[model samples]
Target: MFDLNNFNQESASLIQELQKHVGEITAIRRFFHQHPELSRQEFKTADKIAALLESWNIKVTRNIGGTGLVGVITKGLSSKMIGIRADMDALPIDEATHKDYASVNQGVMHACGHDGHMAMLLLAAKYLSLEATFDGSIVLIFQPDEEDDAGARRMIEDGLFDKFPVDCVFGMHNYPNAPIGQVMISHGPQMAGTIGLEITVTGLGCHAAHAYNGIDSILVAAHIVVGLQTIVARNLPAQDAGVITIASIHAGKANNVIPQSVEMIGTIRYFDPKTAAIMEEKVKSVAQGIAAAFGASADVRLKHGYIATVNHTEQADFCIKTAQKLLKPEAICLTKKPSMGAEDFAFMLAAKPGCYLFIGNGPGDGGCTLHNPAFDFNDANILVGGAFWTQLTLDYLA
Candidate 1:
């Protein structure tokens, strides 16, 4: 239980007003959880978000970057502007949480807590519209395809800023398993950049019994897999952060026959562009060299992904100070480490200065980790997160 007496009179009043709407905001979060949509396929999700914003008399724009939308709340005469974003897509996992409001749609769920994120932002919008007084404009971003594709990048390519440019942007995600009301942030690299890797190894096929009859692609792939591990160990400097994981591999279906080809796919994560390039070079070199030694051929393809989410120094400091004023002393996590997980919000940060922070979503004791089938966003955080966003917005635009 947070004590309102710790805050200034005006801040305390705003929190009290936001508390009155907790039930409504929680309902909205559950509604989104029940009807989750996949990346780039959020038609109904977009419609619902737009309707809610329009009903509040906020200016709404739709179909930016394929299903992404924007809502603008303007007050006073100052042109200074701020942008706040929330991702709208869900994952491909089937719901197993068995909550009363569990997903009605098959094979899709809001496993990443995007439902909670949207609800918090909407709560901020409602309060800002009806109660708060501030200058300049606030842009509420409803982004799509954050789970599988980079919807943030898509929205930027669609000219999100050119149309509704803001001086700075801010984003937040719900962190599962931490203390329910705690807030976490990093002053520098907050999330890692990613590169998608695909490798195909080609060799001759033969009967399994006659092991020497032809070149074995599976044997070559096995060697390559072991070799890729060395990129992080032998190639990269230990001080730098990097990961190379081969999550999937495919080969011959028949046990009695040797496969002619093997395909492997995985991801590379890193904080520095130079480190990423070094890892890429090592992967291609090792794979090709090993395949040739085994009398086979290897082809490597790399797809560029979201950049590392680096927070601007001044903006991050401002957020830290703001969190201190709003949260309990123990609820602020200044020592939290950056995550290897990637985020498309990096694209927006690249376009303008901003900060990305996280709000804790309680413990993960019962299959409650993110992207898990049984995971559900902690409903109680609706009020906690709502207050943080509302306060941050009021302070930034003050």
Candidate 2:
């Protein structure tokens, strides 16, 4: 545990030292906000990041996993190393904030605070390069395509850990609607695993006036949608958590005719693998059974996505202690209830022992929540996030 009394003076000094780099970091964040790129297409984003890191006299490695890069900084004689990660992709949402630095690229925006993440990590890298007294190396990862695809998985498949391995890795994301200056850390599962579901119901097409002549696929599809709900309501235990949402449904084009097939698409979220497996089995069984009862046939497809993000206990405790040194005692929260949302960083945790953290992004009023067009990264978090990153590196590498 961090000694608050012994580290109070050091924390203050670190905050002051971090402040000197805030201006440039904030400007760089805004620049990224203006010139946003979609996943797997972050060519310009990669170029700019590489240029800035090179200018700071850090060794840069490029094209690890399509547009992903790593920056290295070494100090002292120890061989121990730590890895810190930041995502580098923007959503396909148009700019709605109307800020001066709003996205110049149409149909693209930094609605999920990836811009702020990059800036904070960049500041940490720069500060560590200049003032690091710790022994060993620091690996700064700038990953791309976190929105649609798992960039962390891609990086690992492309030999990321093999090329520049570390003892452990760490990642952080901004949490909107939380009080500013507060942080949340979970010891176990912090995010849910996601599964994509696509169901197709096939039946004989017939005129609406004489619907009795043939089976209606649309009607069967509706029943399947309703039946899927029971998987969570009746199948799972009372204490377990899971979600089944039907987001999109497509069937008939005209009111007078029944379509031959209906397509339904949605997502599934759960913290436990057993729960996920049960949901998957139930989804298929329910759809097939309902279709058979309606004289229709069904086909279900499940695309597995990122797994649940489970933080290692020791690393999570270390992170909490490090955060205690930087934040007030009341500002640190150790939560057991995890978010229903999914993160690709879960893949990284699966690869190595690590911890994922959340920093408050202030209020989410006026459509500022994540994935919303009006969302923007709060500039106020630069100092706190950067200082935390810097201090965590120093302590972990010491």
- lDDT of each prediction vs. the true structure? 0.90, 0.90
What lDDT score goes with residue 2 in model 1?
A: 36
- lDDT score for residue 38 of model 1: 96
List model 2 lDDT by residue over 1-398, tens digit each.
12223235658888778778889999999999999999999999999999999998899999999999999999889888899999999999988998999999999999999999999899898899887678999999999999989999999999999998888999999998876646688788999999999999999999999999989999999899999999999999988889988899998889899989999999999989999999999999999999999999999999999899999999999999898877776667786368999999999999889999988788898899999999999887777778888989999988
- Candidate 2: TM-score? 0.96
**Model 1, stretches more than 4 Å misplaced?**
1-10
Pairs with steric clashes in candidate 1? none
Candidate 1 on 133-207: residue-level lDDT in tens?
999899999999998789999999999999998999999998887888677877989999999999999989999
Error of 1 at 252 (Å): 1.3
Model 2 RMSD in Å is 2.7
TM-score each candidate. 0.96, 0.96
Locate the minimum summed-lDDT window of 10 residues in model 1: 1-10
